[model samples]
Target: MSLLKGKQLTHYYFNTSNYTKALENISLSVEEGAFISLLGPSGCGKTTLLSILAGIIEPTFGKVTLNEKNVTETQSEMGYMLQQDYLFPWKKIIDNVLIGPKIRKTLDNQTIEKAKQLLKDIGLSSVIDAYPSSLSGGMRQRVALARTLITDPSLLLLDEPFSALDFQTKLKLEDLVSALLKQYHKTSILVTHDIGEAIAMSDQIYVMNANPGRIHQQFEVPIELRQLSPFDARKHAKYQHLFDRIWEELNQLESTSIG
Candidate 1:
């Protein structure tokens, strides 16, 4: 069943003298516990669409529903992860993960224990008392992921959370994230410009077009590819074919824009 659905989503921006349409008739549905990716070039409204789904912004001409309820009314069940880890430099790793529950006034003894266990699960138990500056880029992102999971969100919105890491680190985190999402049974939507990342991680991919961004096509990753780790998935023969197909579609969109 669809855990989240957007119906004919359209969004616009208005200035004093001009109005711009950021998204046009974009529609998508994410199945429960499934991983989906929005793949597009910059300015394709991938992030915009994600923000709408998160209830950070309202669409001009559509509605977003999470489990048949409007997202705007049930925002607390969603978690958003961004490209930057955004951990405070002065805060200890454990403290950083506690920020959410603390802000919500729900950081009881049980919640604190759960946060510590999350750190342990993400391989950051030893660094619980260490500040963000003491950790490597990959470790910090892991802490960030722990923070996101601390809330027990049903819907996770990932906005290129691994983009800033090194390629090897990115691969490792991709494996970690995919595993954790499946383990937790969380429905996720990722926005990325990386083709291989999308193919390696997503169960489903929605290719988007720019200039009033809209869905161009949707592809389901082969079941065999989904069985392999993200790094190994790259070496699969079918991987290249899917990559080339998406590359061609994106190139065509670019050419049309230029012309």
Candidate 2:
């Protein structure tokens, strides 16, 4: 079943001098436990579309539905992880992961214990009580991942969560996140400018065009590639074929924009 659906989503940004159409008639559906990526050039409104789907902002002319109910009518349990960890420097790792439950007033023994297990699963058991400042960039992101998952969200919105890390860290996290999401059976959508990242981590990829951003193409990752971890997927023969195809499409989009 479709866990989340966006119907003809259109969005606009208004300013004192003028208004800009950020997105246009964008429609998409994500199945339960499927992973997808929004791949596009900058200014293509990938983030805008993600925001709308996350219920952080409403579409100017369309509606989003979760589990068949209008998003506005439902309490969205969707988790959002951004490029920056945005962890509270003052809070310990445990406190950082529990922030969501604390804000929702759902914190208790069960939630706290779950948070501990998540930290352990992510290889941060040694630093469960350490502050964010003491952790490395990659470690902080691990905490952020645990924070996002503590609420047990049915869907995860990942906005280039690994972009800020070093290449080695980014690759490791890609494999880690892919495994974790699959283990939990969570539906996820990632927004990234990296074509390789999209192909490596996604079951499906949507390439977007700019100038009133809209979907330009959709490609499904091969079943063999999808079964492997993101790192292993990159080494698959089919990966290069798909990557070149997306590169050509994106190159054409860039040329059109420049012209």
Candidate 3:
């Protein structure tokens, strides 16, 4: 069974004053352990789609299922990483990472050990007691990732998590995230505006258009992570081809209206 499924999903802002058809007839299946990226223009329902899948919001007109069970109202185990790290400055690194487990009431000796292990895996064991401000932008994001992974979520939903980083840092973290996820065999979906980032970080790419926000095309990356970095992928011949195709798809939505 697919790990996550959205069936005939349609979301509309029903208001007599100002109604909005945010999403319509959207459907997709995410298999376990697949690295999928959603590429789209602004207001193309990309973020809305991620929000629904992460259980932050419910679809207005369809069903969302997780592991073959309906999960439209609540999510089971799912980790979400957003554009901002949202780390609390007052909390120490370890404390921040432990927040999820504490809130879930799953914090224990074993879980704490796992958290520490994850920090170590991410090369952050040295700063376990440091505050958020002490960390670099990339380091802060690493802590954010550790905090998310500490919960051992079955799926990861990344909503432009690397968009704010510098060109160099984004490339570095792309590799780091890909490696860590593969090591743990975690399934992930990344929502990004950068087609290069999508091609570099994903096995499958779903290109989206604006307005009603539907998939324009789905393509497979021809290169492997071991063969190219996010930045390096842009230099590959296939990247040129994919970029042109994706740009065309996005450009087609130029005349569409978004609420």
Candidate closest to the true structure, highest TM-score: 2
For residue 103, give model 1's deviation from the true position in Å. 2.4
Highest lDDT model number = 2
The order of the candidates by lDDT, greatest first, is 2, 1, 3
lDDT of 1 at 49: 96
Over 4 Å off, model 2? none
lDDT of each: 0.93, 0.94, 0.85
TM-score of every candidate relative to the true structure:
0.97, 0.98, 0.91
Q: What lDDT is reached at residue 4 by model 3?
A: 92
**Lowest lDDT 10-mer window, candidate 2?**
69-78
In model 2, how large is the Cα lDDT of residue 3? 88
Whole-model alpha-carbon lDDT for candidate 1? 0.93
Candidate 1 regions off by >4 Å?
A: none
Q: Give per-residue lDDT, candidate 3, residue 48.
A: 91
Could you give candidate 3's per-residue lDDT for residues 85-132 as a string of tens digits?
A: 999999999999999999988889999899899999999999999999
Candidate numbers, best TM-score first, in rank order:
2, 1, 3
Candidate 2 lDDT by residue in tens digits, 54-113: 888989999899899887665447899998999999999999999999988999999999
Q: Clash number for every model?
A: 0, 0, 0
